[model samples]
Target: MSGAPEDLAERPVHGVRGEPFRRLLTTWTATSVADGVRAAALPLYAAVSTRDPVSVSAVAAAEVVPWLLIALPAGALVDRMRCRGTLVAAHSFRAVVTLLLVWFVHSGQTGTFVLLGCAFLLSSAETFADSATQSLLVSAAGERELERANGRFVGAETIGVEIAGPLAAAGLFAWRPELCFAVTALAFGFAAVWILRVSPEVEPVRAAERRSMAGEIRQGAVFVLSSPGLRAVVGTVGLVALLTSAVNAIAVLFVLESLGLAPSTVPTLLVCTAAGTLVASRTTAGLSTRFGGAPVMTGALLVLAGGVAALELVRLPGAAWGAYFLMGFGAGTWNVLSSANRQRLTPGPMMGRVTSAYRVFAWGLMPLGAAAAGPLAEVTSPATVIVVAALSIAVVAGFCAPVLRRSLP
Candidate 1:
């Protein structure tokens, strides 16, 4: 009880500063590169190997399964454990898994099943790393600067994971898929090293008494579901994730088959979208500061809807790139505003659980979205599926706006 006010008072009006914040940001950037590389390389590997939309979707779904299955328990564990240690351990685990994957690729033994399994294991590690990082940032940056901190974090991620990672991986993947995996392993390994060097003070200590994981997990779920604002945010993000994942599930196929782009050139085209994301991350804090988070969120969603719809209409490369750019920009802005709002609403002790619970709805539905994408593309056209997703996203945004406006911090 006594700590609540002290924690509240920790919020600062200015951007976060100091060595710890820098270290955490560095770690995020490094690991995002690893994620980016894997995201691009692995999908291409699947598409190259199987050439089946369903199989590619399977790989995508496998990556997100941990978010649905283990998120709640992982949240509970995060609340009771040291976040920094978790970060290091998770990255280390990913590094080892990636190395094994490289070996499989080298031996020419990699298949759809093995790729899917590896993706699931690597992303399971990500579940821990992501949850722990969110909790750690609250301590390092304080609640007030969460918007800025998350913006910077997102910006770095967009550049590394969305932009640089894809481009680098595309090049390496074109040469030898094994080289891409080696780079991913190296990135995760380095991220662990940076996180290890972060000072002790930056890591929050959650005093523990032996307690049932079920109870802790329940507490987190109740906190999120009991709050209308959190629920609204979760609902809105879930819808977007569903739609976005569906589009992305077939994105490579759309580019290679529909757009007539080569596999090696896919990442280059995506960089247009990544550029929008990078710009949005740099600008979202100021936009929210001026227009307010709720309105900003609403406006960004409108852009996303329009951009996505435009993609279906446009066949020219320039026009399609523009559409993807708009989607990325809107997505980037919405992410910053939503994340900062969640951080502000959640208490320190419950941060881990609340964040994970939020993701269960927000991200867990991605597999469903991915699964839907393949069949939908087979029946109709990929463009038709994207148009439907865009319209649905717009409706969800409109429906959630009033609740979000009333609830946002």
Candidate 2:
């Protein structure tokens, strides 16, 4: 079967270059901000609800477990459906879920278990939504423009999640916790609307064979594992994700307890991180295209290592901001290049499954890392845990440096 219209398929999707692509970016931006607000609020809620690092980290761990548990099923579902409609439905579900959380918070029904349940529900929906949207972008933008398109998406994410959403959530949390959830609900609702308004000029080619779910999942795994480049990328991604999760699991607590900063200022540190990401977004695509994805990834890993190391040496809030800023910059580059590379390597028909499988390997371990961080912090200090994490990240980077240089384009 023929794919998207030849003319539409040939067109590039950059900033405002195509109407449908622009609409997709808008939807992503809005949803990201909403997610950012939720990200900032949930940890704070968990921390406030219980001072135990394990309990607080449990909330974070619950949110990511969906990636490990439901990502494959969700990807299989997405591959068989209309991606756009799937995205809208998923976002709508998130809005409802967030609103319910708002009600629970308002009624003072939010305990640690309740909060974890809500996070799991919200992220389960997100698994489907993210899979569908990423597949849709791959089908819409075409392979040649993958890096550029992903860069734009990452830029929007940095702005929404790091800059606007966190800052807004901080203020709203100070005023009212329910207000933060309410805003998240509204953002998801609006994201659904904006996505619904998008009119794709092209359609994806559907798979003619009606394969069983298990068959499809296996096919995607085979494709990813057989390819050296994908294997390298996934391995590197998993290690980085683990270390990053470890650091983030207690970042807010570190700032408040270790650095003696007020809770109100945690979001400001996040904003600083976002600012660095924004700067990286502008340059990552060009750098990847020029220097190749591997070298760029290597450089980013080193920068991230440096950033994490810096956090140990400097315990002040200002110093933490600078360290996180560097980490964000590295993260921005890695995300854009890695996503684009995955999109480029995977076949269109298997995009959803392949993406899901990749996430399974890459993000599935995040919960474990987070869970480990808490108990480790209880044994040692958060600062000591982060320093160990930094050393681990550097080791992963050193191992991947030569492999990535050999494999990635």
* lDDT leader: 1
Error of 2 at 238 (Å): 1.1
Report lDDT (CA) for all predictions.
0.85, 0.84
Clashes of 2: 1
The C-alpha local distance difference test score for the whole of candidate 2 amounts to 0.84
Worst 10 residues of 1 by lDDT: 201-210
lDDT, candidate 2, residue 321?
85
In model 2, the clashing pairs are 293-409
Candidate 2 lDDT by residue in tens digits, 210-304: 58889888887788888788999998888888888999998889878877888888767777778778878888878977988888988888888
- Judged by TM-score, which candidate is best? 1
Q: Give the residue spans of candidate 2 off by over 4 A.
A: 1-16, 42-61, 102-117, 174-176, 197-208, 249-267, 313-319, 373-388
TM-score of every candidate relative to the true structure? 0.84, 0.83
Reference-based lDDT, residue 332, model 1: 91
The digit string of per-residue lDDT tens for model 1 on 125-184 reads: 898898899987877777778888999998999888877888799899989999999999
Segments of candidate 1 deviating more than 4 angstroms: 1-15, 43-60, 103-117, 174-176, 199-210, 249-268, 313-317, 373-384
Report the C-alpha displacement of residue 289, candidate 2, in angstroms: 2.6
